[model samples]
Target: MRILLIEDDDLIVESLTKALTEQHYVVDVATDGETGWELAEAFVYNLILLDVVLPKLDGFSLCQRLRSQGNQTPILLLTAQDTSTSKVTGLDAGADDYLAKPFDMSEWLARMRALLRRGGASLPPLLEWRNLQLDPSTCEVTCNGQPLHLPPKEYELLELLG
Candidate 1:
Protein backbone atom coordinates (compact mmCIF):
# COMPACT_ATOMS: atom_id res chain seq x y z
CA MET A 1 0.00 0.00 0.00
CA ARG A 2 1.10 3.58 -0.62
CA ILE A 3 0.76 5.80 2.44
CA LEU A 4 1.47 9.42 3.27
CA LEU A 5 2.48 10.02 6.86
CA ILE A 6 2.21 13.62 8.06
CA GLU A 7 3.95 14.08 11.35
CA ASP A 8 6.23 16.54 13.11
CA ASP A 9 7.77 14.43 15.85
CA ASP A 10 11.09 13.12 14.61
CA LEU A 11 11.09 9.97 16.75
CA ILE A 12 7.54 8.98 15.88
CA VAL A 13 8.14 9.72 12.23
CA GLU A 14 11.28 7.62 12.10
CA SER A 15 9.75 4.69 13.98
CA LEU A 16 6.54 4.60 11.93
CA THR A 17 8.45 4.93 8.67
CA LYS A 18 10.65 1.97 9.59
CA ALA A 19 7.70 -0.16 10.65
CA LEU A 20 5.68 0.54 7.54
CA THR A 21 8.64 -0.01 5.22
CA GLU A 22 9.43 -3.30 6.96
CA GLN A 23 5.88 -4.42 6.21
CA HIS A 24 6.50 -3.76 2.47
CA TYR A 25 4.46 -0.61 2.27
CA VAL A 26 5.49 2.44 0.25
CA VAL A 27 5.67 5.43 2.52
CA ASP A 28 6.21 9.16 1.91
CA VAL A 29 6.84 11.23 5.00
CA ALA A 30 6.27 14.96 5.49
CA THR A 31 7.18 16.84 8.63
CA ASP A 32 4.64 19.61 8.36
CA GLY A 33 1.04 19.91 7.24
CA GLU A 34 1.99 22.17 4.35
CA THR A 35 4.29 19.67 2.72
CA GLY A 36 1.93 16.86 3.58
CA TRP A 37 -0.99 18.62 1.97
CA GLU A 38 1.00 19.30 -1.18
CA LEU A 39 2.01 15.68 -1.51
CA ALA A 40 -1.46 14.43 -0.74
CA GLU A 41 -2.91 16.65 -3.42
CA ALA A 42 -0.33 15.56 -5.96
CA PHE A 43 -0.56 11.84 -5.44
CA VAL A 44 -3.24 9.22 -5.14
CA TYR A 45 -2.42 7.61 -1.82
CA ASN A 46 -4.15 4.47 -0.64
CA LEU A 47 -4.18 5.92 2.86
CA ILE A 48 -3.06 8.99 4.76
CA LEU A 49 -1.91 9.07 8.38
CA LEU A 50 -2.22 12.66 9.53
CA ASP A 51 -1.22 14.23 12.80
CA VAL A 52 -3.69 16.55 14.50
CA VAL A 53 -1.18 19.15 15.61
CA LEU A 54 1.34 20.22 12.98
CA PRO A 55 3.44 23.13 11.89
CA LYS A 56 2.03 25.62 9.34
CA LEU A 57 -1.38 23.93 9.29
CA ASP A 58 -3.34 21.56 11.48
CA GLY A 59 -4.55 18.14 10.41
CA PHE A 60 -8.24 19.00 10.69
CA SER A 61 -7.95 21.88 8.28
CA LEU A 62 -5.83 19.85 5.93
CA CYS A 63 -8.36 17.03 5.94
CA GLN A 64 -11.24 19.41 5.40
CA ARG A 65 -9.49 21.23 2.61
CA LEU A 66 -8.57 18.02 0.88
CA ARG A 67 -12.13 16.84 1.07
CA SER A 68 -13.30 20.13 -0.32
CA GLN A 69 -10.95 19.64 -3.25
CA GLY A 70 -12.70 16.31 -3.91
CA ASN A 71 -9.89 14.12 -2.67
CA GLN A 72 -11.63 11.14 -1.12
CA THR A 73 -8.49 9.30 0.01
CA PRO A 74 -8.96 7.47 3.30
CA ILE A 75 -7.51 9.52 6.17
CA LEU A 76 -6.62 8.17 9.58
CA LEU A 77 -6.19 10.94 12.10
CA LEU A 78 -3.37 10.33 14.58
CA THR A 79 -3.66 12.58 17.57
CA ALA A 80 -2.57 12.76 21.19
CA GLN A 81 -5.93 14.20 22.17
CA ASP A 82 -8.16 11.40 23.28
CA THR A 83 -11.48 13.10 23.83
CA SER A 84 -14.98 12.91 22.49
CA THR A 85 -14.86 16.41 21.08
CA SER A 86 -11.55 15.83 19.35
CA LYS A 87 -12.74 12.60 17.77
CA VAL A 88 -15.93 14.24 16.61
CA THR A 89 -14.01 17.12 15.11
CA GLY A 90 -11.84 14.78 13.15
CA LEU A 91 -14.84 12.89 11.86
CA ASP A 92 -16.60 16.09 10.95
CA ALA A 93 -13.47 17.18 9.13
CA GLY A 94 -13.67 13.98 7.02
CA ALA A 95 -11.35 11.52 8.72
CA ASP A 96 -12.24 7.91 8.07
CA ASP A 97 -10.74 6.78 11.40
CA TYR A 98 -9.06 8.25 14.45
CA LEU A 99 -6.20 6.64 16.35
CA ALA A 100 -5.00 8.06 19.60
CA LYS A 101 -1.29 8.48 20.19
CA PRO A 102 0.57 5.65 21.97
CA PHE A 103 -1.35 3.15 19.86
CA ASP A 104 0.02 -0.31 19.21
CA MET A 105 1.60 -0.99 15.84
CA SER A 106 -0.54 -4.09 15.45
CA GLU A 107 -3.72 -2.05 15.80
CA TRP A 108 -2.54 0.48 13.24
CA LEU A 109 -1.75 -2.27 10.78
CA ALA A 110 -5.14 -3.85 11.31
CA ARG A 111 -6.92 -0.56 10.88
CA MET A 112 -5.06 0.21 7.67
CA ARG A 113 -5.83 -3.23 6.32
CA ALA A 114 -9.49 -2.84 7.15
CA LEU A 115 -9.70 0.48 5.38
CA LEU A 116 -7.93 -0.84 2.32
CA ARG A 117 -10.17 -3.89 2.19
CA ARG A 118 -13.19 -1.68 2.46
CA GLY A 119 -11.85 0.21 -0.54
CA GLY A 120 -11.75 -3.08 -2.50
CA ALA A 121 -8.06 -3.70 -2.00
CA SER A 122 -8.95 -7.38 -1.67
CA LEU A 123 -10.11 -7.84 -5.22
CA PRO A 124 -10.08 -11.17 -7.01
CA PRO A 125 -7.01 -13.27 -6.38
CA LEU A 126 -6.22 -13.34 -10.05
CA LEU A 127 -5.93 -10.79 -12.81
CA GLU A 128 -6.07 -12.41 -16.17
CA TRP A 129 -4.73 -11.19 -19.49
CA ARG A 130 -4.61 -13.48 -22.50
CA ASN A 131 -3.11 -16.72 -21.12
CA LEU A 132 -1.46 -15.02 -18.15
CA GLN A 133 -2.96 -14.88 -14.66
CA LEU A 134 -1.37 -12.78 -11.95
CA ASP A 135 -1.92 -13.16 -8.25
CA PRO A 136 -0.81 -9.94 -6.67
CA SER A 137 -1.26 -11.09 -3.09
CA THR A 138 1.40 -13.73 -3.55
CA CYS A 139 3.29 -12.16 -6.44
CA GLU A 140 2.74 -15.40 -8.32
CA VAL A 141 1.55 -16.11 -11.81
CA THR A 142 0.10 -19.00 -13.74
CA CYS A 143 -0.55 -19.69 -17.36
CA ASN A 144 -3.65 -21.79 -18.10
CA GLY A 145 -3.76 -22.90 -14.43
CA GLN A 146 -0.17 -24.13 -14.42
CA PRO A 147 2.32 -22.30 -12.19
CA LEU A 148 4.68 -20.01 -14.14
CA HIS A 149 7.20 -19.47 -11.33
CA LEU A 150 8.36 -16.12 -12.67
CA PRO A 151 11.10 -14.10 -11.04
CA PRO A 152 9.96 -11.02 -9.17
CA LYS A 153 10.73 -8.57 -11.96
CA GLU A 154 9.18 -10.81 -14.63
CA TYR A 155 6.06 -11.21 -12.53
CA GLU A 156 5.91 -7.48 -11.96
CA LEU A 157 6.24 -6.80 -15.67
CA LEU A 158 3.52 -9.27 -16.48
CA GLU A 159 1.32 -7.64 -13.88
CA LEU A 160 2.01 -4.23 -15.36
CA LEU A 161 1.29 -5.50 -18.83
CA GLY A 162 -1.92 -7.07 -17.78
Candidate 2:
Protein backbone atom coordinates (compact mmCIF):
# COMPACT_ATOMS: atom_id res chain seq x y z
CA MET A 1 0.00 0.00 0.00
CA ARG A 2 1.07 3.56 -0.67
CA ILE A 3 0.56 6.37 1.80
CA LEU A 4 1.36 10.07 1.62
CA LEU A 5 2.33 11.62 4.92
CA ILE A 6 2.18 15.41 5.07
CA GLU A 7 3.75 16.61 8.24
CA ASP A 8 6.41 19.10 9.27
CA ASP A 9 7.44 17.78 12.65
CA ASP A 10 10.79 16.04 12.31
CA LEU A 11 10.25 13.68 15.21
CA ILE A 12 6.75 12.69 14.17
CA VAL A 13 7.84 12.17 10.59
CA GLU A 14 10.74 10.01 11.61
CA SER A 15 8.64 7.87 13.93
CA LEU A 16 5.70 7.41 11.55
CA THR A 17 7.97 6.63 8.63
CA LYS A 18 9.67 3.94 10.63
CA ALA A 19 6.39 2.48 11.86
CA LEU A 20 4.58 2.58 8.54
CA THR A 21 7.57 1.14 6.70
CA GLU A 22 7.75 -1.74 9.15
CA GLN A 23 4.19 -2.56 8.12
CA HIS A 24 5.28 -2.69 4.44
CA TYR A 25 3.62 0.50 3.37
CA VAL A 26 5.42 2.69 0.82
CA VAL A 27 5.31 6.17 2.25
CA ASP A 28 5.98 9.51 0.57
CA VAL A 29 6.65 12.46 2.78
CA ALA A 30 5.87 16.16 2.23
CA THR A 31 6.62 18.57 5.01
CA ASP A 32 4.49 21.39 3.70
CA GLY A 33 1.03 21.63 2.23
CA GLU A 34 2.06 22.94 -1.18
CA THR A 35 4.45 20.08 -1.69
CA GLY A 36 1.82 17.73 -0.35
CA TRP A 37 -0.69 19.06 -2.83
CA GLU A 38 1.72 18.59 -5.68
CA LEU A 39 2.58 15.07 -4.63
CA ALA A 40 -1.08 14.18 -4.23
CA GLU A 41 -1.80 15.36 -7.76
CA ALA A 42 1.18 13.66 -9.33
CA PHE A 43 0.59 10.23 -7.85
CA VAL A 44 -2.08 7.97 -6.40
CA TYR A 45 -2.01 7.00 -2.75
CA ASN A 46 -4.06 4.52 -0.75
CA LEU A 47 -4.26 6.98 2.10
CA ILE A 48 -3.03 10.42 3.09
CA LEU A 49 -1.95 11.15 6.66
CA LEU A 50 -2.14 14.91 6.97
CA ASP A 51 -1.28 17.18 9.85
CA VAL A 52 -3.87 19.87 10.39
CA VAL A 53 -1.28 22.54 11.15
CA LEU A 54 1.13 22.92 8.26
CA PRO A 55 3.39 25.41 6.52
CA LYS A 56 2.31 27.17 3.32
CA LEU A 57 -1.29 25.99 3.77
CA ASP A 58 -3.32 24.83 6.71
CA GLY A 59 -4.80 21.34 6.70
CA PHE A 60 -8.39 22.52 6.64
CA SER A 61 -7.79 24.70 3.61
CA LEU A 62 -5.77 22.00 1.93
CA CYS A 63 -8.44 19.42 2.63
CA GLN A 64 -11.11 21.71 1.28
CA ARG A 65 -9.02 22.41 -1.80
CA LEU A 66 -8.53 18.73 -2.48
CA ARG A 67 -12.22 18.00 -2.10
CA SER A 68 -13.10 20.95 -4.28
CA GLN A 69 -10.93 19.44 -6.96
CA GLY A 70 -12.70 16.07 -6.56
CA ASN A 71 -9.90 14.18 -4.89
CA GLN A 72 -11.55 11.19 -3.19
CA THR A 73 -8.52 9.71 -1.51
CA PRO A 74 -9.04 8.87 2.14
CA ILE A 75 -7.56 11.57 4.38
CA LEU A 76 -6.86 11.19 8.08
CA LEU A 77 -6.14 14.44 9.84
CA LEU A 78 -3.51 14.36 12.60
CA THR A 79 -3.08 17.42 14.72
CA ALA A 80 -3.00 18.88 18.22
CA GLN A 81 -6.36 20.45 17.53
CA ASP A 82 -8.43 18.08 19.65
CA THR A 83 -11.49 20.18 20.17
CA SER A 84 -14.94 19.25 18.95
CA THR A 85 -14.85 22.14 16.48
CA SER A 86 -11.60 20.94 15.00
CA LYS A 87 -12.92 17.43 14.51
CA VAL A 88 -16.08 18.73 12.92
CA THR A 89 -14.09 21.05 10.68
CA GLY A 90 -11.80 18.32 9.59
CA LEU A 91 -14.66 16.00 8.73
CA ASP A 92 -16.63 18.74 7.04
CA ALA A 93 -13.57 19.64 5.02
CA GLY A 94 -13.43 16.10 3.56
CA ALA A 95 -11.14 14.24 5.92
CA ASP A 96 -12.25 10.65 6.40
CA ASP A 97 -10.98 10.52 9.96
CA TYR A 98 -9.31 12.72 12.58
CA LEU A 99 -6.69 11.81 15.13
CA ALA A 100 -5.43 14.20 17.71
CA LYS A 101 -1.77 14.24 18.69
CA PRO A 102 -0.67 11.91 21.49
CA PHE A 103 -2.91 9.19 20.07
CA ASP A 104 -2.30 5.50 20.55
CA MET A 105 -0.45 3.80 17.74
CA SER A 106 -2.66 0.73 17.95
CA GLU A 107 -5.76 2.87 17.65
CA TRP A 108 -4.24 4.84 14.81
CA LEU A 109 -3.38 1.64 12.99
CA ALA A 110 -6.89 0.36 13.51
CA ARG A 111 -8.32 3.56 12.09
CA MET A 112 -6.04 3.23 9.08
CA ARG A 113 -7.16 -0.34 8.50
CA ALA A 114 -10.79 0.64 8.76
CA LEU A 115 -10.44 3.51 6.30
CA LEU A 116 -8.46 1.41 3.85
CA ARG A 117 -11.06 -1.34 4.07
CA ARG A 118 -13.62 1.19 2.97
CA GLY A 119 -11.49 1.78 -0.18
CA GLY A 120 -11.74 5.54 0.27
CA ALA A 121 -12.13 7.43 -3.01
CA SER A 122 -12.15 5.91 -6.49
CA LEU A 123 -10.66 7.09 -9.74
CA PRO A 124 -12.69 7.33 -12.88
CA PRO A 125 -13.53 4.01 -14.54
CA LEU A 126 -11.37 4.79 -17.52
CA LEU A 127 -8.08 6.62 -17.26
CA GLU A 128 -6.83 8.33 -20.35
CA TRP A 129 -3.49 9.68 -21.46
CA ARG A 130 -3.21 10.87 -24.99
CA ASN A 131 -4.59 8.03 -27.14
CA LEU A 132 -4.06 5.39 -24.50
CA GLN A 133 -6.90 4.18 -22.31
CA LEU A 134 -6.73 2.02 -19.26
CA ASP A 135 -9.62 0.34 -17.54
CA PRO A 136 -8.74 -0.40 -13.96
CA SER A 137 -11.73 -2.67 -13.39
CA THR A 138 -10.85 -5.02 -16.22
CA CYS A 139 -7.08 -4.54 -16.06
CA GLU A 140 -7.17 -3.79 -19.73
CA VAL A 141 -4.98 -1.40 -21.65
CA THR A 142 -5.43 0.00 -25.12
CA CYS A 143 -3.90 2.61 -27.33
CA ASN A 144 -5.59 4.55 -30.06
CA GLY A 145 -8.58 2.18 -29.90
CA GLN A 146 -6.38 -0.89 -30.39
CA PRO A 147 -5.83 -3.55 -27.76
CA LEU A 148 -2.38 -3.54 -26.18
CA HIS A 149 -1.60 -6.69 -24.35
CA LEU A 150 1.31 -6.63 -21.96
CA PRO A 151 2.84 -9.01 -19.46
CA PRO A 152 1.76 -8.70 -15.85
CA LYS A 153 4.99 -7.07 -14.73
CA GLU A 154 4.79 -4.48 -17.46
CA TYR A 155 1.13 -3.92 -16.77
CA GLU A 156 1.74 -3.33 -13.09
CA LEU A 157 4.59 -1.00 -13.90
CA LEU A 158 2.48 0.97 -16.28
CA GLU A 159 -0.33 1.18 -13.75
CA LEU A 160 2.02 2.59 -11.15
CA LEU A 161 3.67 4.96 -13.55
CA GLY A 162 0.40 6.26 -14.86
Q: Model 2 — TM-score against the truth?
A: 0.75
lDDT of each candidate versus the true structure: 0.84, 0.87
lDDT of 1 by residue, 72-107 (tens): 888999999999999999999999999999999999
What C-alpha lDDT, on a 0 to 100 scale, does residue 1 get in candidate 1? 49
Error of 1 at 84 (Å): 0.7
- How far does residue 23 in candidate 1 sit from its true spot (Å)? 1.4
The estimated TM-scores of all candidates read 0.78, 0.75
Go through the candidates in order and give the clash count of each. Answer: 0, 0
Alpha-carbon runs more than 4 Å astray in model 1: 121-162
**Angstrom error at residue 89, model 2:** 0.7
Model 1 — which ten-residue stretch has the worst lDDT?
116-125
lDDT of 2 at 44: 92
